[model samples]
Target: MSVDEFCRFCHKNLKIKGVFSQSTKIFEKTSNAKTVFDRLIDLGLTLKRSPEKSIRTCRRCTSILSRIERDLPVFRKWEEEEKQSDSSEQASAPKAADQSNWDPPASKMPRRVLHKFWPNPPAPNQTRISMSARRSITEVMTHYPSSKTVCNVCHPDDAGIVNNISKKNWKTAAGLMMRHKDLVEEIKVKILELVQHECKTLCNPSQGFILWRSSPEDLKSFSFSSLESDLNRLSPFLLSIFSTATNHSLPSTCAAAAIAVRGREPRMSAFSYYLNSILLHGGARKAVFKKLSKMAITTTHCHAVGKLKEFPHTCGEGLQLLEVQKEVLPTSGADGLTDSAGQDDEGIDLGGAIGTHRQRDSQLKHDLVDSSGSQAGQMCQEKRQKRRQEQSTQEEEGAEWVSRKRLRSEVQPSPLRLVVDCSFDSLMMFKDVRKLHKQIQRCYAENRRTLHPVQFYLTSLGGQLKQNMDETDKGWVNWKDITIKTEHYHEVIPREELVYLTSDSPNVLTELDDTKAYVIGGLVDHNHHKGISFERAKELGIQHAQLPLESFVKMNSRKVLAVNHVFEIILAYMEMGDWQEAFFTVLSQRNGAVPVDQNGQAVEDKEDDDSDRESDGTNTVKDNTSSMPDQQEGANEQIEAK
Candidate 1:
């Protein structure tokens, strides 16, 4: 039976109807209207009193409520046949007594046809991953299917169904790598042969060199299967293009490193394993991070690109774009976007200036002490001179005042010093080291794009790479814009002066004043090293500031985020001046965790998997290398030599 729905606010009976079912499954005749989050202000009962749980609409609140997806009603559409049969049964039935005998015939039908279409049975219930784990994966990447086993393309559990990777696709990627590698070597060798002075001339921030590598002919000629099959031999070339401009010449400026390649590989590879050894030896060299996805990142806003059918440049969000071939066209900076925002201020200032000039003219006519002669008197001339001098002086002072204010506001009293506390407890293990490397690489990338790149200090000096490191093997590659001191961060920055920005602290980072320099721990201890950062901070007596996460938005996942993700969030917040805006810009609706209000108690990480699929992009290390078999032989040997 249809029941009238009423808004608690207007108390008006809506067109919406609620067929009361013992089950939560929604019946027909409910209206879906736009819902708003009134931010828990005294905006009445339309929104709730608590900010987090306040997503209510006293009106027709259908699927309008967001963030909390489980709150949405499960609608079951009533079929036309069901309606007809019910009507016929009512007409044919004798009375209310016979109505018990008459069951709705259509109710026997299943809501969704199952088993008829060939497929496996419904999956059994799964143990939910912890919120911290969800967040770690979310931080470094866009959504990939739950790849529990090996890649479907590489070793398909089932034939005829590809899980986003194919053999031929690997061939294309490998082909591109080979061609790029060949071209780079050729260019560099040719330069060495021809020029004597500086081969560094090819180096640029925005290098516009596109190679038609991976063309139809090249793909056909190359043994892609062999390359894909034997990744160890092929990976070094990919690494060259991906991470460094060393062995291969990667253009300094590229929009994306788009890999419209087919094929899937495991998350852990020979690349990461070998990388771990290198770090253990020389200490983590140019830190590293990956992935295949459609990426549309403008300098301002990063979002999903529309369908490829509608727009051609929009390679699927899953496809990673190349660095040189950037995803976005250059647009005016934030200043241009808000040029009109300051219009009112300009208008007021202009009006004030005009009024002041009028007042000065009036004073000249009235405030003159003496004017005796018909032909312009000496007093009049003196008054005019005085007025002109005053006007000039006033204008000069106003200009100086504005310049001074702008300098104070824009110029830094002290530039924000960001630290990478690489000095973690020594026996931390392998996987965490890899994750830490990925974090470092990501921070470097984020800093490159920051409006004012932060001064990065990579502290905790001693390790393997430092032992026999040559003069040429040092400094961050192609990142002159950023001040990153590996081990040297302490030379300039005192350890005591550093304030840790970690989740361990209770102090929410509401504002960043010109005073304290912030530091992010370089260790990825998983949850195994929980509160290590906080403990370290406490022991050192360095003040700590946690990100204002719960204060700003509701999250389901754990508060801990990847190093680069945190840095980018801070940079985004600094640029936009809003925590919410910065959070949304970097974190997607699905992958990002939002916490709800819970009586000041410790917020539980619920078994919610709904938002796990949403992602901004792949957060994998851009080391330009993928993984290999975990126990690839000679891994130790290779690290020892390199």
Candidate 2:
């Protein structure tokens, strides 16, 4: 128990002297009333050799205890007066038998004597006291769990004190109010939980990372060097929490949990920011960040390899509020980290509360073989290097051979044109429809504006199209061989009328077959319309296939993607003939499906592609890049007139 809470109940004693003597006397004489010490012992608290310094007094005892030594201004004067009074009045005089048995009255002194020996020196009559908490912030936190209560006790000032705290001289009259409390490590943990919670909200949720206390001597332990090496390659949210002052802050004082957030640049080189907050130091907490270099820690996507690269600066307060909210109303990790305002507005891809352990394993693995042939391998490598050096030294070399391999590598064409279903134009909002028009126009221009390998056709377009999206003519459509029509998809094609693709579809398109036309819904639903194409495809009795988003990646947000994004994935897949490669190429770095660490090694997930097998017997396991080019030759095919 804190010093003020002597018995867990404040005795509110106006005056106190000889704290230990009075406590011992009360405990020794009490018969019916349980003493604070007795109560503490009965609670099975004395099992340890050392006392629980955090809790000292019991719930029922009256307090003769006072504030912390530093809190009392006239403590030296009070102790001196009591000592002088005891020496001059009582030491020389002998007590009578009746008086010896009688105990001195508690706090029964004249107003003048008490005023001179007041427990708390009277101040200019102020209604509310404005100072650091009477007890340490941690001590007060233990008593009151609410952030508001903790803030009130620790900061006292609501306006500016909580945010802008400067160090004061230790020897000054008011003493030091700021204490060293390191929240870096704790805040890092909370950020991960928040991001994990919101992973379901991002178009692509990335393999996230948390790095702490990195020393140059031990960079490998937390992958700090790896982070820097891949810093430029990273498309991620970088949030660093740092104190404006030099590394160490005041210790054992009221420290803030959530602080201000500013732009992030000096670290990850991303358009991110750092959050600054006060940390409260308790018993053993160093309060200062252990390493000066790591005084401010960061959390973000691991070794960015994909396109999704920005974290909105507006989401700062929302992320910090998450840490505060979960502590107040504790719940399961699945429960979103949010205030009463809701997680949608915050844009933090965080769902679920903190402290859930998501396993971390290397997605990339290589087997090591130790054998007697090591010496042979080393000699062979030396020989190769020597041969290369000797060749460079030579004046003349053999004539270079020119192979006709490029001429022989022919791309076989297939009549499998991909049709764009423009039927759901009205189902989406105006903004979404507009984005769809712009994206479609750009998608063709970037990939295949002239003699494109993949044939593009726009079908099921209604006549009442918007001005720019009109059926008559637009930039790419007017300039290129792009086909645009107002016929329903079923009326345009017969055999494989419509092979609709969507995110929520159950079937995974395993192979691309010739003579079958694949249809993509040309719609971008930013925040409106879901499952529209899927439901329409089902109603039309057409084959429905969702791009294997679930099979290839795990997204923080819904797997639903933009029209252009899906179209690009299809083109890359047709060229690469590998779902994993295409998914990685087209999806944002945030997609959780498979995460590559800083070394570009795949993080191993036991339940990933290896565990899953397609009916066609295609091994989903990733292989070396050298083998992919060979497969690309057979996979490359163009759609033509049947």
| Per-model CA lDDT versus the true structure | 0.42, 0.43
Worst 10 residues of 2 by lDDT: 360-369
Error of 1 at 169 (Å): 67
Q: lDDT at 108 for candidate 1?
A: 26
lDDT of 2 by residue, 1-642 (tens): 133323222223222453432333323446687654454354222222223121233322333222322323375568578879977877689865576577664333334433322324435674533222232231123335454453234443222333233333334312222222334455568778864443222212143322222221122122223333232133223211222232423210101111111112123221111111112111111223232114333222221101111112223332232223111111111122112444333442322222322311122000001222346556977898977666665625664433223232343433557777877666666655666677776666644521224666788776334454654344444545467677876887884556877766789888876667788877655435667778878788888887766656655445666666777777777778888788888664533345444444455544354455443456555555675454443222211000
TM-score of each: 0.29, 0.29
RMSD (Cα, Å) of model 2: 27.7
Name the TM-score of candidate 2.
0.29
Q: How accurate is candidate 1 locally (lDDT)?
A: 0.42
Residues 1-642 of candidate 1 have per-residue lDDT tens digits of 112232222223343344322211122223463224331121122332432121123322332223223321222233555677878997998768555676554322232321121122223475432111211111112345775444222211122112212445665544443434345577677655543222121221132111122222221222323333232232334333433543333322121121211112122121222222222233221222112121211100111111101111222222222211112111111211111122121111101111354564453333222322333566677888987787788888884322212332353322676777777726456545655665676777677655656666666644432321222235445545455445543455776677788787878888876456788876665456778889878887778888887765564445677677677887888778888778767765454344344443223333222233343346332331232232222232121000
